[model samples]
Target: MKEELLATFSNHFEKPLIDEIMEEGRLMEVPAGETIMDIGQYIRSMPLLLSGAIKVLREDEEGDELLLYYLEQGETCSVTMACCMGQTKSEIRAIAETDSRLVMVPVQKMEEWMAKYKGWRNYVFESYQNRLNELLQTVDSIAFKNLDQRLVDYLKKKVEVTNDNQIRNTHQEIAYDLHTSRVVVSRLLKKLEKMKKLELHRNYIQIVNL
Candidate 1:
């Protein structure tokens, strides 16, 4: 699993460094719907996702979860922020969306690896920069793009991977990704379905246009 996690960073670093990092890491399994990291709990290690997905969510005073971001396979958690700031607690909860395999490494071990391996350090730095760039892009899109535009753009990107006009997704899942309410996504999807642009099944939305 650690080998698979390191493969995601393969393009950013040398094979030797990736091997070393994996060698020093340990694997952990997280069950679906479980908290990988709870809000207000200290994160002593970083978890590199090897399989499955996780969601970063914020809880309100009333205990309602607001989706912040989603972590796919090959992505690492934001535990680095807590480690760097020496924070004793986190404000966000990392919840596993599916049964997940993670490559965990202690902060001290990560620091030691960075000191000993230049490639490893560079890879981590690049990962942070890439994540920051993604967040900035999301902010820009939300600020300037309307919901329809955003949804269309998202479908286009998904179509590239799916290689078909059809997509499998739910209104709730789309809302989570779009950082909007389910009612909003449902309303917009209804319009799209009426237009024959897609079909809404029991729990999945299928796009009909390429």
Candidate 2:
């Protein structure tokens, strides 16, 4: 576990620092569909994703959630860093998009590392920049794009993230992600099928192109 964890963190950290962090961290596996962080949960640790994928979503006061972005291999949840730094509660949710393995770094080390470790500091800043850009893009998609275009983009993104053309989710699930109703998603999907953009199966969507 240490060896693989070390290898996973290598892109952002040196061996010595990785070893130190490993001493303070514990590697854990998250199952598919499991929630890693929930709204209002205390920020105890930040996870370093080693394998598989995670979907980060933001919830509104109405308890409605919209997909913010994805964090897969070689990525960390930046919002967790914010909560860790300020001793605040989590404002977003993280769910395992696939069975994923990650190392949980205690919140104490997070602050100290930012002040003390160059690698850690660089990682935090990079994560913040990356996630903010993703969120901005999400906003742009929602505000400027039509529902069909957004649905098309969403399918392409799911394929890119999961490396699977066959998206194993129901129309209701897709609607939830898109913040629409099942009937609307079903209608658009039929339109996409007529356009030969994709093929729909029971509880799944197979993208033929785009």
Candidate 3:
């Protein structure tokens, strides 16, 4: 586990900090589609992704969800870090996008390490900046891009994160992520199919031109 931590995070964290993580962090496995954290929950630990992907989302009062960003291997959710630092409830939901392994670092250690380790502070700050940029990109897409174009971009990102051209998400699931009605998603997907950009199957969408 220590070796895994070092191999995945050594570039951003020092050996001593990694040693502490190995000692203090709890390793866990989360299956695909599992809700690891939900809105309004008090965050007790911060996750360090070891493998696979986790998608962070925000929900409206009506329960529609919007994809915020993905946490891939060697990445952590800055929103969760913020909740940890502030000792506040989570404002975003984190769901496993694929079967995943991660180390859950207790919230108490987060502050201790931030004050004790320069590398930890740098990692935290960089994560916040990266997440902010991603949020900006999402806002820009919603503000300027058409629904079809946003759907295409969303599909491309899913392919990149899973490293597969085939997306297993159902149309309704995709609708929820994009914060749209299933009918709208299906219509756009069909349009994309007719355009020869992708192929729609019973349970998955296969990327061709996209």
Candidate 4:
């Protein structure tokens, strides 16, 4: 983990900043399918993902979750920054999309770094910009696209993140992410299969194309 931290930090951060981070941060490994943060949870430590991916979800008033985006290697959580900066709570939930490793930095260090290091400030702003762009794209997709188109987009997104055309999510899981019913997801999957775009199985969908 020490070597991994050095490799990751060397890309953008200065040596002194990296050393302080290594000294102050704690390394944590999260298994696949684990929820790292939930709605309304207070932020204490900011996580810097070193490996694997995180699936970010926005929960509605009724507790239904809508997929927002994926945060992969070297991507920090923008929501974490918002909560840390404002002394607020998390509005979205973050789940490990794969077996993951993260370096958890105390909220104090996060704030100090932002003020003390130009690199840290730049990273924070870049993270916010990237997340905002992703959210805007998500809104556009939901507003202007049909359900089938959205489903295809979701599947393609998963493929892009995982680099695998085979998506190991059940229809119910897909529905939960897409904010639709399982029956609807199943019907659409069948339609997609018939169109020769994918093959549906018990738990996974294999993309034949796109």
Candidate 5:
């Protein structure tokens, strides 16, 4: 765990802060498609990604969910941190995008470390700014971009984060993340295939021109 922490966060955090994390943080491994946190759940700890990716999601009052952003190695979710600091229930959901490793830091230590460590403070502020920008981008995409374009962009982002040309998510899963319908996703995917942008299969979609 110490080695993983050092490898993932050594550059971003001071040695003393790293030591504190080592002493207080609990290392965890999560499998792909696992829901680690969900709406209305009280957040007891903040997760620091050690390896792999996590997808942060937001749900509507109707219970429809949309992808907010992806958290990669060495990054943490700002929304989760906010809930932890505020001692409130989680408004967003966190799921493992791949087989993931993370360090769960107690909520109490989060505020304490902010006051004691410059690196921690910077990290927290930067995370908030980054997440805010991503949220704005999501809003823009929904408001301005056509569904076809948004679907392409979403596929590209998945490819980027996973570093895989073939997307393994089913049409229904894609619909859930995009907050659309499975029928719509299937239609758009077929259109993309006809346009030579991608190839649809029984389960996964393969990138061709995308």
Candidate 6:
């Protein structure tokens, strides 16, 4: 299990430093639909996802949940920033989208390791930089891309499990992720269906090559 955590950080650091960090880490199990972190909750640890997926979301003024992104295996939780910055609260919620196992390192321990290990410090810096880049790209996409283009791009990027190229997500869920409205998504999906680009089952949409 510790080796798995080290593997997740291998892209950013030397294997030896990762091994040292993993030595201080412990595995945590989260059930599906569980909130790992809540708004206003201070995180004392950083989680490295070892298996399954989690959703990072925020609530709007209307109390609607808006998806910031999904973290899968090999990805570390964004809560690392809040913990490291000594933030008293977090606006984002990390919810387990599936039953997940995570390697958790206490914030204080991680800080200590950074002071002791130059490689580990570099890895954390690089990880934060990469995360910032991803956030900036997401913001740029939302600012410039239309709903149709965003939907198409999302579909292309998402994994579909059905053999028929079908995606099983509700309009409200899709709207939340795209920062749009369900009505708009419904209209766009209908248009695509009419053009024979896809077929809509009861709750799933199947995209087919023309």
Best of the candidates, lDDT: 3
Query: Candidate 6: where are CA atoms >4 Å away?
Result: 10-20, 160-166, 207-210
Model 5 regions lying over 4 Å from their true place: none
Rank the candidate models, highest lDDT first: 3, 5, 4, 2, 6, 1
Sorting all predicted structures by TM-score, with the top scorer first, yields: 3, 5, 2, 4, 6, 1
| Model 2, runs deviating above 4 Å | none
- Candidate 5 displacement at residue 83 in angstroms: 0.5
Off by over 4 Å in 1: 2-23, 31-33, 59-66, 79-85, 153-179
- Against the true structure, candidate 3 reaches a TM-score of 0.98
- Candidates in order have lDDT scores of 0.71, 0.88, 0.94, 0.90, 0.93, 0.73
- Could you give candidate 5's per-residue lDDT for residues 78-164 as a string of tens digits? 999999999999999999988999999999999999999998999999999999999999999999999999999999999988888
Name the weakest run of 10 consecutive residues (lDDT summed) in model 3.
Answer: 1-10
lDDT tens digits by residue: candidate 3, 1-210 = 888898899999999999999899999999999999999999999999999999999999988899998999999999999999899999999999999999999999999998999999999999999999999999999999999889999999999899999999999899999989999999999999999999999988999998
Per-model clash counts, in order, read 0, 0, 0, 0, 0, 0
Candidate 6 lDDT score at position 188: 93
lDDT of 3: 0.94
Query: Which residue pairs clash within candidate 1?
Result: none
Please identify which of the two predictions, 2 or 5, would achieve the higher lDDT against the true structure: 5
Please identify which of the two predictions, 3 or 6, would achieve the higher TM-score against the true structure.
3
Which digits, one per residue and each the tens of the lDDT, describe model 2 over residues 8-113?
7787897877887779988889998999999999988889999999998887777667888999898999988889888999998899988999989998888888
Better of 1 and 6 by lDDT: 6
Across residues 34-129, which tens digit of lDDT does each residue of candidate 4 receive?
999988899899899999989999989898889999998888999888898788989989999888999988999988998898888888899999
lDDT of 1 by residue, 91-149 (tens): 87888766788887777766777778776677577667766776676677888999887
